[model samples]
Target: MDLLDDDELERSAVVANCRMNRERGLLGSNGYDRELGFNPLDVLRKPSGESRPAGWLDLCCGSGKALIEAARIVHDEGMDVEIVGVDLAGLFRRVDPDQDRLRLVEASLGDWRPDRGFDLISCVHGLHYVGDKLALIARAASWLTEDGLFVASLDLHNLKIADASPLGRRIAAALRRAGLEYDRRRRLVSCRGRKAVDLPYRYLGADDRAGPNYTGQPAVDSYYADA
Candidate 1:
């Protein structure tokens, strides 16, 4: 079996055309609030007026609808918030020009770095297509503010190895030790504050033909060697 590197994985049909959460909103049955188990707006804090707007970074932000909706709400409420939505496809839905606080970016999360730390960072179902899931997670976590919140949906089964049954347990333990929490049943990983996570594994590559995960979507399986 052949494995694809990050660049190859990004160019693959399964990843380039992935439309996960394309139309998801900020709040609703199929929205960020429900998916994240809390209203993202509640976590957004504006300190001492507009001197420094609260930042929210949404990775793999397909279509950026949710962030756009949040931007509208912030505008209406006169809240100081800056929202950035990044997607590899870069095919974002049309938005109004009045949305000055919202920025839709097209780039690969594997190498893209934000200019500033975020108060809240989310990745929805985006990690399903990433080649180096753990490495990205570590990078995202490190990009958070001291009291920032980072949440993402992750399928542990996709973290592949030669013998992966015990890999899940080990991974969960390592994450916990690094101040990140993994919900086994919910397939979610979350953390409060910035964490410098150094997992003891090297990313070998990814298998894009691994098939469907719990999301009932075809996802990539990341392989790893030893550190």
Candidate 2:
């Protein structure tokens, strides 16, 4: 089947209404904190009295509850930090309308780009919806500051070429060559520094027909144009 275009996917009401349904702490039941092996707040925390502002960017941020919660924590700690979140979803609630440090944007991650780099960038359970996971990873890496960290949840099997053929090892090789680390067991991709890298495939679009991922919930499949 031909993959759905990015614009079409973005306009889908079903796709745009998704939410993370954040809890008080674990964000969701995904064990994200455990997989990360560190508290996100630690990375976001600035010295209690420092004036230097730190920033974080979260892509495919869903309802941006995690960013909002983080913003509240940092604010209560009296640290200067800025948190920006972007998602394709149509409606996202502002955790704190009074907090200027937090900005939740509703837009497609496929085309949206941050104006500045961030100390940390993350996409939690977001890659599944992307049509070009590798391209987006490369783009996210570029959005990170020097020595900054970029992390996302990814399933290698969800990637395919124009013919629905999996790139398999080629994807890992490209990511490593570009300085990103893919943890197959964790189903996570991470990088600590930014580098320019290109893959051999062109993104055709996404497949929403595929249903129920490992989490027993529906997710999108990414299709690429293979050479």
Candidate 3:
């Protein structure tokens, strides 16, 4: 089976048709707070005496509606926060002219890098279409602040090796060893604080025609080789 690289994966219809997280809001049953297991606003709020501005980076932020809403709350509460949302499709909703603290960017997670560490970083069902999910996860985890939180919806079955084995248990054990937690039931991966994780696998490519998994949506299958 021929697999697609990162750039090729981006152009595939399977990745383009991913809409599981496009309309997610900030504070509802189907919202970031519920998906991430914590309120990002609470993480961004300044502590009792600290003065540094809190930062949040949301990856694959479909329309950026959640980030925009968070920006409005930050402004209304007079909180020192910076919100940055990035999406590969670049189809974000327009924000108010005065929502200066919020920035929506169009970029690929494979190459995008933030200039500053964030107190909270989230990726909602974004890795389903990514070619190198582990690499991107490692990069995102490393972008966290000393006490930051990183969370994302990840389906372990989508990660596999050359023989088509999912390697789910092995991967989960490795992730836990690296200070990351994987909730098998929820299909959520989370990490506290910054970590430089080096999973012993080399990404080969991705199969965009893998069809649907647990999410009942078309998803990509990433293949890897032992490093």
- TM-score of each model, in listed order: 0.95, 0.88, 0.97
Computed on alpha carbons, the lDDT of every model, listed in order, comes to: 0.87, 0.74, 0.90
Query: What does the lDDT read for residue 121 in candidate 1?
Result: 95
lDDT of 1 at 84: 94
Q: Rank the candidates by lDDT, best first.
A: 3, 1, 2
Candidate whose TM-score is highest: 3
| Total backbone collisions for each predicted model | 0, 0, 0
| lDDT leader | 3
* Regions of model 3 farther than 4 Å from truth: none
Q: How close is candidate 1 to the true structure, as a TM-score?
A: 0.95
lDDT of 1 by residue, 1-227 (tens): 58899889988887975557788888999898888888899999665654778999999999988988988899899888999999999888887888899999999887799999999999999999999999999999999999999999998888877543335677788899888999887788998999899998888888889888888889988888768
What digit string (tens of lDDT, one per residue) describes model 3 on residues 1-227?
79899889999998886476678899989888888777889888778788788999999999998899899999988999999999998988889998999999999888889999999999988989889999988999999999999999899999999899887888899899999999988889999999999999999999998999887899999999899
Taking the tens digit of each residue's C-alpha lDDT, what string does model 2 give over 1-227? 96688788766543653644333243444534664656676786765675557778878776666667777877787667888888775356657665778888877777788888788888877787676788889899888877778988888888876777776577888788777899888788999976676767777788887776764656778877654
| Lowest summed lDDT window (length 10), candidate 2 | 19-28
lDDT of 1 at 37: 89
TM-score: which is higher, 1 or 3? 3
